[model samples]
Target: MIPYVRDIKFEYGAVDQVSPLIRRVVANNPGPFTYVGTGTYIIGRGEVAVIDPGPDIEEHLEAILKAVEGERVTHIMITHHHIDHSPLAAPLKARTGATIYGCAVTKVVEDDGGVKTEAGYDMGFKPDVSLCDGGEVSGPGWTLESIPTPGHTSNHICFALKEENALFTGDHIMGWSTTVITPPDGDMSDYMDSLDRIRVREFDTLWPTHGPPVREVTPFIDAYIAHRREREAQIEQALAAGPSRIRDMVPVLYAAVDPRLHPAAARSVLGHMIDLVRRGRVLADGAPGPDSEYRLAG
Candidate 1:
């Protein structure tokens, strides 16, 4: 596993320590884990664009306002409309009067098979302008293209800065964890295509919604692609060993995977098994559901 300290960068109504143009303002609700609620940062230009304001903490929002004290904040961009990432958009707009931009899929009210994140939590914020693919946001010296990167969520889009050579990759590609392709909202084909898009693009840095910026991005993207491919092989091997269940494949397929993250690993295995069934490489007898089972297809 790649281990790195995710330092936050704070400046101008925005917090830094995350990247050259990125910042992380600590939120109120840290989250379900020990090291959580690190929030997110703004990317590019003196008049910046904030990505994922994080959970709604009055202090955090106030800190953001203070961080961007004198700067005329132009835009508030949503990475995927996830609560932990976006809840502050509306409130911040009330505070700073900046236009919010995101995708239709993101602000669609429900995320990931009707899972309500913002409702239970106070992190709900909607966008003023929701965009689709190939859209551009131009300011005086900065221009960001809305690059569609639908995988972690169909609404998930990354922002590409033209002049600065940076991409704000929401949860699409983070330094800490492989993106979870949780079905319905997430699609494997779209995620792979998004990875392909990054491989062919020219970008010096990556500002992800969650983790730290990957200074040299292309290599990390390549590595992500390789990681996914490797996982695919591992799944197939686990299947061929004999008839199996997600529980059965866990040890053989992800023995080296973090024990604490087994449930997540199981989710990935579910996606893999679904794909394998489609390709006729494996048969499922309720392997992921009641009576679900799996075996070598051919």
Candidate 2:
């Protein structure tokens, strides 16, 4: 089981210095997915870099501006183009005169078998500086190396803080819950590969955009990998019984989970099915998708 951290004591819009060189300001857009809203991170001191500017809320934008009152925001970095992660980047850049950096804009997955437009994605996010894997960006006292972790989204990038030996994991890895991997753009095969890549890295901590920091690095990542493998095993077991669709398997797979999140769960199952079909472990009628029926291969 993943050691989940659900509770965090933080006031919305207040910039709290979580580390020697890292400060966080939580946006007040709380929901099922965004636990206590988005945690916008401020890296370095006088000349700083902001990661994940978060949603386009006026109050949150005002708070960010206030937090960096006399400082120079050299870079506005984003992890992905999720609605809650990058909407405020343009406005923040306009105010601070900072160049936006992070994932390049890609084709939006209109119908990935489960969700459609307005599916919590930011379609208008276009970064001024698109960073690929191993890309580095620096400011006055800090340096960040980008690690492309394309799972939660095809363009997801995790920034590593060299000074702190920490990784800003975005939604690739979260302390609060398992990431939702929808099909098409969200690939389970890529997600698993990214997890393996992160496991071999030497990082002391992981700071997720939604929840509290993950301090026990190795065990946490190991648990995450194990949890995903268990989910895959469950999928295999479900397929062994007979041919099944993602919508039919979700209730049995996530019986303990809240009913409201079942839709998202089904999408994640579709990601797994796609991976299974590619590996020849499962056979789909056509292209693996949310509605496609699948069964164990011979």
Candidate 3:
């Protein structure tokens, strides 16, 4: 069965009660990457916990304040340090004195001679309280357990709401599109591992930052894992057939896909090749970059 995605017609500051435990206020920033803007989630009743405050847009900040007008926002949590996710955390913290929580700054790996990709970090963000895997934070009637599912970004985390049996999946998982896993920071190996991590967990639903909630948890997880593995197989086959460069493989592998999307697809292919090289399945001349040549390992 296909996942049922809720169509949210958001008006900047309006608060929509998604469930008894959750209210969502979407920021105005919408795009291909962010389906209908960032849905800043307000969890719990009186003393709420705000997750992914979204971009630094002042209007978004005002909207959150209005949503929790009479209630106290005790905790502010970030899924990752990307510009669209963590920029507003500082303002929310200052206004409510809410304790900010998130994973520490992303750790930069020594460039493996691969194409160096920068996903633009929010360098100013420093969580007042750092959350590690299995850490718990509570407010009013809800408790969220931090699941460090790093892949979309080195510091990405998903919060599992204990009361709702739902996971607040950051960009690590989204309903609208497959995640962009650029290497050095975004690891295909780690991304696949994280998907497997979530597959084993007990969650009935997922609340992603961008689009609607995912209801078919197990099937969606299974399909996502299978889709990526299939993509890897396609890349390996292409390599075996002699498409040595990413640009060359793009047309061969992504012929049916939009030409405009090929550039991004090429990056994903590079990430897969890097992982393949690490696993000894494929060989790259140097670090996996657009210019790097690849071949099946003998």
Candidate 4:
């Protein structure tokens, strides 16, 4: 009998086509929040732990408030400093006096708002309580644990709700698309390591940031790992074909990748190329250009 429930949108100000994996009603935006997910995890009528209180949409925030109407919200836990995920933190806190928790990745997340001219993000909200890897905050019906997942973003934190045996994977592992490994902020090497780390953890479900919960955890991990390996091989093969730039491998490396995410695909390619150079498998001199070209190490 939850009354306050806001319908989050999937389509947004930026994206034209909504991917199948994303849940809730949300739009892809030039704004800070692109995809707002559904299924609220309220701890109690008044006391709830909102995993990602997306966008500062009055209606969206109001729905959350309405759902917990007559109840006092105690927590606002952020998985990362992504503008979309953390933008509403401040407003929600001001209204409910809920303690906000997020990793120390805000400055990087706000990146001078250069991309805002392009990505259209409404930069708002900041965490009040900082949560570290393996940190826990317990309240009424839930004990939320932060699991540092560095890949999409170095400070990204995944949450585990002990009572439900559920791991809320925010962009750490998504059902729709392969999470991007954007340089500086996101690290490919760290991503693979985190993937390996999650393999051994016991969890009944994986509640992804963007989509529905994954029922079978291990197979999804296997699929994710295999998918990554396949992409890695593709990168290597693209290199062996001749002197290839990241753009040259774009079509081949991301055959079925969404065109809207071509930039992200480019970012992943850049990260992989850097990793390859480190292992002495490939060679690089500098950023994208003739120097950005790559070939077999030997």
Candidate 5:
């Protein structure tokens, strides 16, 4: 199991202090992918840094503005350019004059397979300061180190709060569920490498944008990695029978999952197939994709 944390106590639009140096204001956007909604985090006091300002709903914008009413928002940090995560940054920046930092927008736009309607990428998002892996940004009392973990999206980056030893994992390692790796931009090879990268880091806690905090950090990450490996194993087993399309394998691979989510599951399976093809473990008819047929390498 992934040691999922589902229950979070918070009223929408109200700022709740989650830790000594961190406070969260939940946006009123909830769904299958968003869970309760986007938990926009405020780091440090007085001169603070806001992480994932969330969607562009007027209420959400007002909530964030109210939360930082008397404080100076020195920095606006984005994890990725997803519509839910980065759309509010522009308006927030206009209001606060804060420098936007984090990953740049992905240039390539592939068929997201209906996943875009739920949580699409915000192509207009461009950071004033692009922080690569090991980059650092600071405020009055908090310093966040950028840990680029680009499996969820090519530009997805996690911010680590040095003072609290807490990592703000965007969609890379959500506590509520496994991340959806939609390809072309979302790669399984890169995602697995990113997982291993975070696994070695001794972080005290993980705060995902969409859900509550993850306290048992190491075990949670271990289980996440194991789950992916298990899925890969299942794919391998399925391939032993014959060449198969991602859509064909999704039903058997994700039988327990909601049928509504099978499309997303197929995209994840496509991610695995891309990785398998790269590693020479599986052979694809053409470029590995959602519609491509695959078989175990001879």
Candidate 6:
């Protein structure tokens, strides 16, 4: 079953309190991938830390400023370098003098296609502080501990809010839809590993950058894991039938899915095939691409 999202009326630039410590301002950008734009989270009151300032939109900046009126911003923590999540940090930092923090610059593995996917990258973003695993920042009543969970992208990190028993999951875990694992930049191996990493963490609520907050942490993650595994099995079965190209596999595997989403689905299929190749369960005739031929391993 697909994940269900909470009903959130996204009025652009309006700050809504999600919890006592968390207020959200949705950016104006929304689409098939970005369910309701990006949910820019304001953590803590008085002196706050803004997580995922979101897409450098002026109105979003003004909304965030208005949310923390009569207060100061201590730090700006981004979950990852996704465009919809990180661009506004510069302006916010300029206005509030808050230190911006994120994981180090991403080092991606190039696919056989020899083209890197710039799906969610913001080239101009440079975090003031680069966090290591278990790194942390503190404020009046809140503390954010960075957990390196590279899956959605090589540099993706999930921040755990100590005060609220919550985790800012970013694209690693979203309530609206399954994350797009576009290969070369997005790895199935890393994504699965990150999911396993999150499974061991202590977080009651998962506040994703898109969609509403997920309260049932373990079950939701388990479902995500199962979904990927099931998709992998479907791909494996398809390969067992005969030699197939990536395009040929998409309809066979995702026949029930919207044809419009097939391009995205093909990437995820390629990601899974790459993982299977690494595991010696599948054989790729050449660098895996839309036209690459595949068959079951001997």
> Scored by CA lDDT, what does every candidate get?
0.67, 0.89, 0.85, 0.65, 0.89, 0.84
Residue 289 C-alpha lDDT in model 1 = 44
What TM-score does prediction 6 earn?
0.93
Model 6 clash pairs?
none
Q: What are the per-model numbers of colliding residue pairs?
A: 23, 0, 0, 22, 0, 0
RMSD after Cα superposition, model 2: 1.9
* Estimated TM-score for each candidate: 0.81, 0.95, 0.93, 0.79, 0.96, 0.93
Deviation of model 2 at 87, angstroms: 1.0
Question: Which ten-residue region of model 4 has the weakest summed lDDT?
Answer: 14-23
Tens-digit per-residue lDDT, 1-298, candidate 1 = 3333366443323455554455566565544321245455655556877767765667778887777777877898887756677777788888888898987554233333532212222224456887766588876567778887887777777888777688878778776556777654556667888889877886887776554567757667778888887877887777777887887777667678777766656666666666667667778775344136788877
Question: Residue pairs in steric clash, candidate 2?
Answer: none
Q: How much is 89 displaced in model 1, in angstroms? A: 0.8
By summed lDDT, which 10 consecutive residues of candidate 3 come out lowest? Answer: 110-119
Query: Which candidate tops TM-score?
Result: 5
Instruction: Decide which is better by lDDT, 4 or 5.
Output: 5
Q: How do all the candidates rank in terms of lDDT, highest first?
A: 5, 2, 3, 6, 1, 4
Candidate 3 local Cα displacement, residue 262, angstroms: 1.6
TM-score (C-alpha, index-matched) for candidate 2: 0.95
TM accuracy, model 3? 0.93
lDDT of 4: 0.65
Segments of candidate 2 deviating more than 4 angstroms: 111-119
User: How far off is residue 237 in model 2, in Å?
Assistant: 1.2
lDDT of 2 by residue, 39-70 (tens): 99999999999999999999999999899889
Clashes of 1: 23
